[model samples]
Target: MLRISAEDDRDVAQFQQLHEDAKKNGFGRIFRSTFLFEDMVKSILLCNSTWEKTLAKMVESGKLNLEEMERRDMTAEQVSEKLKKLTGFGAFVTATVLMCIGYYHLLPSDIETLRIFRETLETTAQSFYDRFFPFQSLAYCELSQLDYKSVSGCSHIKQLKAA
Candidate 1:
């Protein structure tokens, strides 16, 4: 889910430029943060639900008023509490907020502080996984010996090679 809190002022135009660059570089899906309440609610919906169910529920809800979230006086803790009151949310969202507690300490008291915290947790998770248990060529070597690329569904690796 998109956990946004206010922060100190910074270069918005630069952030937009970075966003555009990320989009061009195929990171758009990971960096999608617009001012739309629907998008934000959709982000919440997607927290634990399957993609189809989340989209369907958001479309069904039509509009979710989360603008109070951007209020200068609101705290992330308060916002998280209010969000839990909403109908569709569940424990997963609550857990996510708990996970975000460390970041909340530095949260801006104002919701319009002008800077977006683009945490790279997803990238960090992948890096951690790779560091601990990286992709091993031995697995691939055995698979290749068996000529089981088709059965094992290595289409992506094949595409990578062709490219």
Candidate 2:
């Protein structure tokens, strides 16, 4: 997730100025050194009980090729479609993979994330997406990281929960 791309770093740095909450929170890029395949395996393990055996078999048989995906520089949509065809991959897992691969435009919301946004933030997923646009996931992540009490005076996303 944390590739050392100066270009990406610059873009994310500029993104901080776009949202008031993001600017207030000093949001910045978080790098992860783990490979995308490893991230996928970790995400898969969370949802699928037979994840170990299934993932091993899939990779060994060349069904899920990380190299090819990287080489193609496939869009998040393309990657998502391929992952959705596999077992144990719903929107959450697929979105996790896409995010790990640097696709911050997509929001990866599980049921809890949905509940918190609805109950705590008083905002729907649509509203979050609408506010943040291409950087929705990044903004969502930063907002989620804030202290609930600290953000009480902010617009919308009230009663935020610490996550």
Candidate 3:
């Protein structure tokens, strides 16, 4: 049997706190793999593309033979090339898909994530990564929700507007 252990370190403690806080706020853990293909397509569509364009591309790509792509068992580079031929996906989008496929560590940094970091944390992406380290994506998800709630008045809209 495979065994795992964690030491009682500051990093571990911080991660536990973050996870608990997210759960307390009714934010369930995000398992991106459940909808891997769709997520990959959406991530690709989002690169240097408007929301409307992305939606349109999603509809268009939906008609393609995605299962065939899966059957080929291509390398990440080959998969990227094939996706580009099929959907005109850019390097960022290709990298995003590779990241999804467990080949990369970093999340695809995009304009929206950058905006969230700037508006919510008032800090650089590098600083955010340094603070969160391995849990950057999880931290981003939690903080992004908080940021949206703060700006959009998820509760007490009138009070927020008044202030």
- Index of the highest-lDDT prediction: 2
Write model 2 residue lDDT over 1-163, tens digit each, in one string: 4554775676577777677777788665655546667777787777654754445677778877886665447877888899888877888888887767767676788898777755644443446456678887887678668843455433434323322
Pairs of residues at least 3 apart in sequence or in different chains that clash in candidate 2? 2-32
In model 2, which runs have C-alpha deviations exceeding 4 angstroms?
Answer: 20-26, 31-33, 121-163
Ranking by lDDT: 2, 3, 1
> Per-residue lDDT of 1-163 in model 1, one digit per residue for the tens?
3333333112333344667865466331222245434444554565545554333454357553344444434566675676566654455544333333322233222222222211233333334335335564554455569855553322244332332
lDDT of 3 by residue, 2-66 (tens): 11123223334454576786546744223354545676657755664655434345445675444
Q: CA lDDT of 140 in candidate 2?
A: 62
Window of ten residues with lowest summed lDDT in model 3: 1-10
In candidate 3, position 60 carries an lDDT of 59
Show how many residue pairs clash in every candidate, following the order shown.
0, 1, 0
Better of 1 and 2 by TM-score: 2
Considering TM-score, where higher is better, how would the candidates rank from best to worst? Answer: 2, 3, 1
Pick out the ten consecutive residues of candidate 2 with the lowest summed lDDT: 154-163
Model 1, C-alpha of 26: deviation from truth (Å): 18
User: Each candidate's TM vs. the true structure?
Assistant: 0.31, 0.64, 0.35
Each prediction's whole-model lDDT (CA) = 0.42, 0.67, 0.52
Q: After superposition, how far is residue 119 of candidate 2 from its true place, in Å?
A: 1.6
Model 2, position 138, has a per-residue lDDT of: 84
Shift of residue 141 alpha carbon in model 2, Å? 34
Q: Give the C-alpha miss distance for residue 115 in model 1, angstroms.
A: 32
